[model samples]
Target: MTLGAVAVLASVLAVSCAGVVLLTEQALTADLDQAAALRARDVASLLPAGRLGTTVPGAGEESSFVQVIGPADQVVSASANVTGQGPVIPAPKDARQVTVTLDSSPLGSEPLRIVAVPVHLPSGPGWIYVGTSLVQLRTTMSTLILLFTTGLPLLMLIVAWTVWRTLGRALRPMEAIRAEASQIGHSDLARRVPVPPHNDEVGRLATTMNAMLDRLEASSRRQEQFIGDASHELRSPLTALRTQVGVALAHPDPEHTRDLLATIDQQTQRMAALIDSMLYLARTNRSPPGSLTDVDLDDLVLEEARRLRSIGGLRIHTAALAAARVRGSTVDLSRMLRNLGDNAHNHADSTITVALTTDNTTAELRIADDGSGIPPGDRERVFERFTRLDQARARSSSGGGTGLGLAIAQQIAHAHAGTITIDDGDRCRGAVFIIRLPLSAHHGP
Candidate 1:
């Protein structure tokens, strides 16, 4: 890029200098012609008026040739340089000046620019001619051309060098950024690009790159934490399954072995559930929702409530359900509802209330359980993955959950452009998990 820019600049400079040289040459030529005409006018004024023949002045320091001619088109008097030459130019029909070139002259074979002016002299009507050699003018123009041709390239080279230095200094910071960025790796996200002192584009780029590194580092830490938590959760079930199987093998009795096998199956199911939840979360994190359709949220709520009702321990109240439709993936919406219902069932003391309703623009589903209510401080924390609020709410008689239900529910809600929040229950002194989704366009009656 620098080379290209320098090349273009040099081209423009060369063209401009050439134009200046040409213009200078033309201006010099015009000045010389004007001086010759003035000399001719002065010599004509000194001659006898209405004269036919007059001795013109000799060649002077400025190297001009003068001549006087009679009305018969014969040279009567001539200057020293053109002493024996015939009339250098024909007499003009009028007094106006005219330019002519003399090809043959006593001085040399060089061309001369002559100006002829008709004058009325005492002897007769005559013409005066003033001629000047163009050798000096041509020489001056040649010198100017030589200087321009030689000096322009030197000037262009100097300019190119200066521009190259300036651009290198200006881009030094960017080079530093590139070098630092190249050294950064996934394991070293803590490193940042150096910011320049000047608040220019380079500085902004450095700041942006540092900000991206910050995000990558935070994301990496979260990933590592998630893997650690998942490994711990999986190990518990695997250890229990191995111990139970080992005990069953040692006993080898049919009834005892059957009980042991049943215990092993339960543990296996728990592990399967945990793995399934992790897979669901991972899938959702990796991709956005696909195949959206109008989902009847009320029907999903009622379905989960009915399924929980068959569990038989708690009374499920879902009479407040209304036709609430939302646009989202049906499977994701169903998973969200089931997660919320399962959480409520696991925590409720005696009764769980499931209610669904809609306002003008939003569909709301609230699931509350009559258990030890979640503290204000712990409400949000309980929704984090692998969080078990066993102290805040009693663990279900069935077992402690894998602690991913509320987190998965929240992820699903957010995927559908919705929000899930914890608030006080409307019917009982328990925690209420409210899910709010935007209403579909065709939702109204």
Candidate 2:
């Protein structure tokens, strides 16, 4: 990059300096030509005064000289500097003015800028030639050319050096980030790249990268914990099934064998349910969300209420069900609603209220049970996998169910780009799981 910048700058400078030299040459030559024309006019004025052969003042100092020629193109008179030279330039017939440059003049070896003008001399119509030396103009132009030839390269070198150093300094942080990122592994996610103090682009990039690393590390830790908990939960049913099988094998009683088989089936079902929940969590959390369709949330709420009513015992009140349409995976939404309803069923005493309502932007679903509410401290913890609370809030069931219902519900809600939270504003006798999902764009009254 630095080299390219220098090359571009050099090209521009070369073109500009060449233009300057050309313009300077034209300007200096124009001035010299004008001076020679004036000098020839003054010398012509002297011819009618009959002083054509007199020595001219200031004309001898430099190689400047004057001459007069007869109409027949013969040398008539000359300046002191070129007294014996024939007419340096031939005379013209008409009284027209002209200018020329002579490389080798009669006065000296230096070039001359000369102007010839017709004059009415005392002898007849003749021409006056006035000239000035070109040594000074040539010297000035040579010095300028020399300066540009040497100085332009020096300027380019300086520019290249400055650009190289500035770019290196700016990219130094990115190099450090690359090195740090390369060394990071799954085993060591705690390390972070160095952040420069300046609040520039590099600093912002480093900050963003570190933020991503922080999220990755937190996710990794959570995954490890989830694996450990899942292993422990699965082992419980396996241990029970193994012991029950061993007892049945050792005794072989017909009546107890039936019960043993039932127990084994129950443990196996529990293991299956746990594995299914884990798989669901993995799929929902690890992958992108699936294709979504508009689902009537009110229908799902009424369905859950109907299911609970069929179960008997508890009074399910869904009087607040309103027409709310949302966009989500229908099967996943159904499973989420079912898990919440099951959680309410497992904990409710005499009543469960399932409510659905909507506003301009979101649909809110609240499922509250009349059993003892979760403590304020454990409200968030209830969403964690296999979390157990006190006897009143512990998620227990006759089917040896895995305590993954709330976790599954929360994951499903998140997959729909929604939120599920236990309502802290409810000061009543039950936990209220309030889920807010974004309304579909086409939702209407």
Candidate 3:
């Protein structure tokens, strides 16, 4: 338990008990004082005035512990042992009887309560002072105090122990998890935190952590594989470039050197394209967290089509729809559009049709080309990095592709919680790339 909780609990318990104790004591003392005053008034009125004041040194004085006040507020009578002692509690001033006390301390007197009363004698309404011993009351109060003082520590100790034990049990699983997690790193992604059987907040936290670890492990493996494959792909072109240069160097013929230089230039372009695609892929993974913004998909597609149409590679036609939007990073969205446009221009035998439209729930952009269509079975596989459609690689000049354009496009689409799908193009044996984003991207009044 925290010290603060302990202090609060202790204070609450003590205050509650103390209030009840004090109230009980006050009631008892008031009752006793009233009883004492009544009896004293009766005893003093029955005695003669002078005789009440007369003192006895031995037997009478030893037991004498009372006092009597006259009507004029004079101590006309007193007990020898109690003379001028105890509070000078005033006689009742009004006709209606009331209770009052002067001492603030609980143990102010051996008899804590005293009272004064008026007695009607032949001379006048003389007053009588009455006080009783508080020895018995003191004994009772002392006993109660002793009981509270003795039991309070034991009660708090039990409470503290219970709280401490509960807190430890609650945190034990997390401690074990922390220790196990400390030894786990990139090499030991297989290790996982043990989630307990109970369904509690802590259990939920452990489950979430375990799920995160699993995702990280899978992502790490994929990254490693990508790096290794990229390295191999880059090395192959460089090796071809070196081989061509070596052959030209050995022959020293001008025609041979020119052919070798051309071959070297081709290989260099291939390597450059590969590196550029890899750099784009790296950018896809380097997307800033929490950077999504509303994007106008309709305007973007029409703009891209307009820009590509002027290049004269292939006629870019657009059938744009209004208010086609999504929430995503502008950089990734532009890259996705640029890659789709590049791929469409490269493969299209004639015209590239860019269609932009939206359903009530989703926005879609379709880029279709008038070229040989991809087989249904190979459509999905073609989007993978370094994947080529055999024939696409054999094409001349700009038509030949490194096969990363589609992969990069898919990655950017997925980053925006969207998907890219392929279908048959209209009036052509070509493929259509359909990219869909949720309509939640449309943030408007």
Among all windows of 10 consecutive residues in model 1, the one with the lowest summed lDDT is 391-400
What is the alpha-carbon lDDT for the whole of candidate 1? 0.80
Best of the candidates, TM-score? 2
| Model 2 CA deviation exceeding 4 Å by range | 41-58, 68-70, 74-78, 90-99, 116-128, 391-401, 425-427
Query: How many residue pairs in model 2 have overlapping backbones?
Result: 0
Instruction: Please estimate how well model 2 matches the true structure, expressed as its whole-model Cα lDDT.
Output: 0.84
- The CA lDDT of each predicted structure is 0.80, 0.84, 0.72
- TM-scores of the candidates are 0.78, 0.88, 0.73
Worst 10 residues of 3 by lDDT: 55-64
Q: What lDDT tens digits, residue by residue, belong to model 3 across residues 112-158?
A: 45565556644567656555555667678878877887887788888
- The per-residue C-alpha lDDT of model 1 at residue 280 equals 85
The residue pairs that clash in candidate 3, if any, are 110-134, 111-133, 111-134
Error of 1 at 191 (Å): 2.4
